[model samples]
Target: MLNSRFDMKDMDLAHVILGIKISRTSNRLTLDQSHYVDKILEKFSNDDTSLARTPIDTSKHLLKNRGEAVSQVEYSRVIESLMYLMSCTRPEIAFVVNKVCQFMQKPLNSHWKKKKRILGYLNGTVNYGLHFTPTHLYNLTWLVTRMRTGHLIVMMRRSTTGIACFWVQILSLGNQRNKRYTVSRSSTEAEYRSVASLVAEITWIRGLLQEIHVHSSKPPIIWCDNSSTVRLTSNPVLHARTKHIELDLYFVREKVQQKN
Candidate 1:
């Protein structure tokens, strides 16, 4: 309190420092590695090295150092450096770091070369800074919660809160066909079934959010990768195709009618 005799030092946190770069302004703050990456690239002279479109080669199988041992001090230093970089600003370096760190106990010639390449890559990207926008705080959302688990309805908690708009996850389920629904159903029926799956997920997650402390605007979004499903959801009248479904379901219509 202003009335209490307490000493506080005002440290100005305004500029990027070390490898952990931070940028701040009256309205926003950003984290990144443009400067640090650039310095590392130049220091290791990797600017002219070929830049691969992708990071680690998907085909290459890299494992932890389980073969022989490399010089302890040198390998340890390199891994430590990479770990700092990965945690601070460059996660593209993570796989590379892990790949090399595995070799810390017993590094091979090939691993050493790859480590050098990673360093060079870092030098080229030091100035890179990750930008983050301010979070748009929102109030609560009014939507019923339902719980079901599968590939269909596992929307990320992050996106629901409006911080992240969308995220997609592909899951492998054991059952290829819906055992409950009859096969050879109309396209509308099939579409509603998919939405039923998604709504199950949305409701379940909203409930989980409440258990924690996450809320959203009314009527959470149900972004179907399938547009046909979207159209089917917009319609309310249940015909031969959708009559088998319920009004509460066929939620595409039920939800949009309320204005999300």
Candidate 2:
């Protein structure tokens, strides 16, 4: 009864909130921002750019521009828009957004082109949105993807749902840039670092759910493709090579031992 305390009128139904359009059906609901994407494209004068299938070009490596900045003002503006878009309904492009953000201070021409490519990709997938349906179980699974350069870490949570009898990503928990000053030496270290980050987020979520009186049927499971990192999680033996990330190892190991 918020109505009893405050004078308020009913807004029949929410078609859009914070620029995100909400579409619903009998058993499914979708959230998208096609209008916002179009506005971003038009504002940046990329309305006529060629459509790109992917958000970022993987072949070209994005590095710090040591040369003179190119349209730094315009570049930062586009990045601000994209960052908002990415946080709202386009978690799929989180990696690209995070990558381009690194060059926001002194964005080069290449960086500007990279941002344009993201707009082009959005042009092709304007209708793409996050879909949700009925689910019988509340099983949570965290998936972590390590970047080739061992710098970026993306984590998403997939909940097992009854609608399609398949795993669907229901939430994006993390798409964080590397806070550590030094990059990991190996792929395993990178994957392990990602896992540690995922576990920390999972722990926070579990605590929040508990506070709200929602409990999972079982403990959440973390999924990673790296074989070495997977083995290292349960392995008791610690090597000198892994001494640098010793704290991370213990933190993750303690959680695993508790079956969290």
Candidate 3:
């Protein structure tokens, strides 16, 4: 189609684009940035650094730094590198990476150690990548995790092949910051906001699919661990208790009514 309009040439095949390497098989296509991962590790990590099995320690709490900054510029550089990797192929470390990002301006020694731990984790799994396979079936699912102070939204899709793919495109970029600048009064309110955000993104994706002549036989499904949030969505009455989050609540209810 493009040949009939503007001037263009065929590159034939692509193995790498913007540091991401693509590999293909008969039934699947995979993307990884092993070279980029190695570069990041070598630039910021030492040769004798021990490998870490996980990106961050779950038991440890990362508090705001109150002392002097330790290599602030270098710390920002490392975060940028990891952010790119996290944006591209690595979704497992999204939570930890974003958690450390909160302290980028004045990172302390503890924050630097956390950054090194991420590098060590990467060193252990440099070959991890995203995989996609051919399939006729498509379903969209959103999983929202509500926390006391914040929330994590993960969108996933499954193909007929039964292989689940984590969709982190939004999280890697748009979701780094919260849509609502203020805090919600309750966890249910937070869940509703998250669900509304996911529905908005899914609507955009479904439009893109339609533009490309692709269609799904069913509407997207959202899987939330919170029962109250689910009940609120289907509940026809909006109580005065949820008046604070009425906007988000109405947005979600409207989408649900549309069978989205």
Candidate 4:
């Protein structure tokens, strides 16, 4: 037969592709790029350095390049490389990457040091990666939502919204938005806005799952520690104090009625 004339060899499993290392087992799959991280560190880091406990230091502040520039081109290249890594498997470093990348045009020594600190952190966590384990088959009872709010310390009055969605305990999607959309009048308003953002995110996820032929027998449940925000979702009455956020109220209420 034609098949008998051909020779094929099985490699068994894939180890690396496009800088991501893929490891698989019967119950889970883990993707990491420790080798790639090591190359990055070796490329950018000095021989004498200490590992950082965190990727970024919140206590320190970064300003525009008022000081002398230091290798802007090289600084940009490092940020670009790290960005690829962050987008691929290291979403935890998103905040720091975003922070350091703002000064690509004229990065200062401080910014360069911060970028190196991120590299150091990556050096410490080179073996870390996302681990995905199998969820219960044919069970649609699993859904998780989280929300948080904070005032932007750098921007003074601006607030931020953070949300994450999980399916079977695995993070499916997450987002953070600085509420330049509208200035919230109070912490409660900011928290309510975050809840609205969470609702919109869940709705989109639900629609995507449906399109992929996955069906949920029951509605998804969202958990919030803010009792006032929880009441706002079900109260159905928009008082004057909540008029600024009226649009969000309608959107969340409609989703709730549909058992989102």
Write model 2 residue lDDT over 1-260, tens digit each, in one string: 88999999998879999999999999999999999988987888544578899998887766663445798788889999998998778877877787788777778877777887898898889888788887766667776766555222212211111101112347644444443344567778877877887788788878887897777777787778889999999999998899988999999999999998
Instruction: Compose the digit string of candidate 3's lDDT tens values, residues 71-96.
Output: 98999999999999987888777777
Residue 197's lDDT within candidate 2 is 73
Q: Pick the candidate with the highest lDDT.
A: 2
> Which candidate gets the maximum TM-score versus the true structure?
3
lDDT of each: 0.50, 0.75, 0.73, 0.73
Higher-scoring candidate on TM-score, 3 or 4? 3
Estimated TM-score for each candidate: 0.44, 0.85, 0.85, 0.79
Window of ten residues with lowest summed lDDT in model 3:
154-163
Where does model 4 exceed 4 Å of error? 1-13, 65-68, 137-156, 174-182, 223-227
